[model samples]
Target: MNYFFVINARKFKQYLFIALAIIFSAAIVYSEQSNVSVFMNSEPSAIYSVQTEKKVIALTFDISWGDTRAEPILKILKDNDVKDATFFLSSPWSKSHPDIVSHIKSYGFEIGSHGNKFDNYSDLSDEEIRNEISTAHGILTELIGKEPNLIRLPNGDFDKRVLRIADDLGYSVIQWDTDSQDWLNKGVDTLVNRVVSKAHPGDIVLLHASDSSQQTHEALPDIIQQLRAKGYQFVSVSELIKQTQVETTPVEDQAMKQIH
Candidate 1:
């Protein structure tokens, strides 16, 4: 009887261990399904840095709610003869500024989704996250006649879930390599200095186009001139991604192109 009891106890422990292992594996799979998908080989990765022999970089702007600087900034780019940059436009922002969205495309600028609302993706349910991406994508396509294949999560907030949803929705999630920090209370001189000091070949620099982004606006021409002085040429986010040899198109672009 003693031996039988010991054997039973050992079997019980074994069963418990197996149960725990299953639970752990389930947790991992759940986590992956809940968040953004990961690329094992980094073949379809976003541009976090550039790899060109010459000095070149991409400048990107996030337009969430405000549009005070949108037209003027666009003019600035035109005056500077800047051909390319990426603008991540939120859904509501596009809804309110359809003409501006059109202008962005008409001027040959690349558009990227900034989600449906200006809310943080970190606070959204998985379904909500997918909805946000899809909604913004639809709105942008309807307005500009092209679905954005790139995205910069609102407030730059992202996680595995966010990435997975973006990937599933067919976007290459983009992040900045150089932050101008022009949205902060930094003085114009300091802001320019920070960017200039951090500027490098093949960098993706982040800026903003809201009312509070005046410092960024002020620093733009100077940054351009200085980077030019250093022999750097500006390119769009998509171009920069291509330069690095990473795939930038989301799966959605192909499908939408087919439909159109």
Candidate 2:
């Protein structure tokens, strides 16, 4: 019996050692895989918002196809003395309405590219994306007499490849954290609440000056008033980017992400 007991103890010790060795090997393999994943998933840079505590926000308007809506928005900005706004103008629209483009430029508002085609860049070929951005850049530069360094993809659609191409062309892709959804023309109250409630430091507010948005011009006054009452000051998108220490993360499609 004593001899059998000794044999059983020896077997138990051996099995325990094998189990610990297997666990250690698995841990090492997991650590290596994690390191590889971190390197492989590095994301390109895009400015959605900044990392700052200041009460600053950027009121950005996208004008893709419109002549009527922009003027009212411009007037509202001027009346409110809100000088730090950004307008991303599509090349085609700017070509058709040079006078309005001039008015926007006259206000000293920072102009950016809204891309030439109103299509999802993530769905386009890499070469096609490059052409769209470059074409828009040339047209806007001629109209504004200054090169546009910022861009907001049409429909706010983009992927990592699109970001890489834009970066190569000397553009910083600007995305918004707050969306007024005025394009829906839901109501002046809904638009106002969407913006005022979501307003935060270093926020980029997406509003449209395109004709599709019927209520943005009307909502602008209340939006500005409420934000100011909350202690948020408006800045140009470029200024907002400049004010923060930029950080990028690996996200699939976050251009249209809304702050909830």
Candidate 3:
């Protein structure tokens, strides 16, 4: 009986060692996977390095609902010969403003998904998030005859799961580096100054074009003029991404830079 007990104890000790080794291996793998960084906002400055070598930036707008100033915004962009800009449109907004959508495409601008229902994506489940992104893609593609490859999370809220679903749906998530704060009812001059002071090559700028965004539209000309004076040429978000080197650093360590 003593001999049998000794043998069983030896076997138990071996099994314990094997279990510990497996647990340690799993922990290491989990740590590595969790360390992969993902962008959580829709601002480019959050994820990209601004290139100071050349004068270039992307002007982007988000249209969630209403058409109070869509036409005027379109006209201003057209009049200024601004061919490179991105518009992130909600499905409801697109449905109500078909003419504006047509004009946006006609002007040769990039279209991106703003979400299906204009709800905060952070509050949604993974399946709900996927559906929202996919539905918007389908609508925009039907309207413009080309599928949108980019998406901006509604209200600038996102998580790794949201980004993963977007990637699975064939969209690159975009976050802006510079926000015009036109949505906050700041004066036109104030908005212009904010953009100019933060302007750098390869920066992605955020703006709006709905009725409430008139201040933004009013500030557009000066923002462009001042940035141009500094030798900054505006491009679409897609073009801006193509123009810079993408640095894949951990999202936690990512710091917003003026010009990299």
Off by over 4 Å in 1: 1-39, 42-46, 246-260
Ten residues in sequence with the least summed lDDT for candidate 3: 251-260
Per-model lDDT: 0.78, 0.88, 0.77
The CA lDDT at 88 in model 1 is: 87
The TM-score leader among the candidates is 2
- Writing each residue's lDDT as its tens digit, candidate 3 over 1-260 gives 99999999999999999999999999998877666333323322224335557788888888886777667777778788777889989887897788889989988989998879877776788889988888888888889898898887787766666766787788777777777778887688899999999877778888887676768778887887788788878788878778767533234322222110
> At residue 121, what lDDT does model 1 achieve?
76
Q: Report the error of model 3 at residue 64, Å.
A: 0.8
Please give the range of 10 consecutive residues that has the lowest summed lDDT in model 1. Answer: 251-260
lDDT of 2 by residue, 119-162 (tens): 88888898999999999999999999989999988887878889
Question: Each candidate: RMSD to true structure?
Answer: 10.3, 4.6, 8.8
So what's the TM-score on candidate 3? 0.77
TM accuracy, model 1 = 0.76
Instruction: Work out the TM-score per prediction.
Output: 0.76, 0.82, 0.77
| lDDT by residue for model 1 (125-166), tens | 899999989998998889888778998877777666677778
Highest lDDT among the candidates is held by which one? 2
In candidate 2, which residue pairs clash? none
Clash totals in order: 8, 0, 8
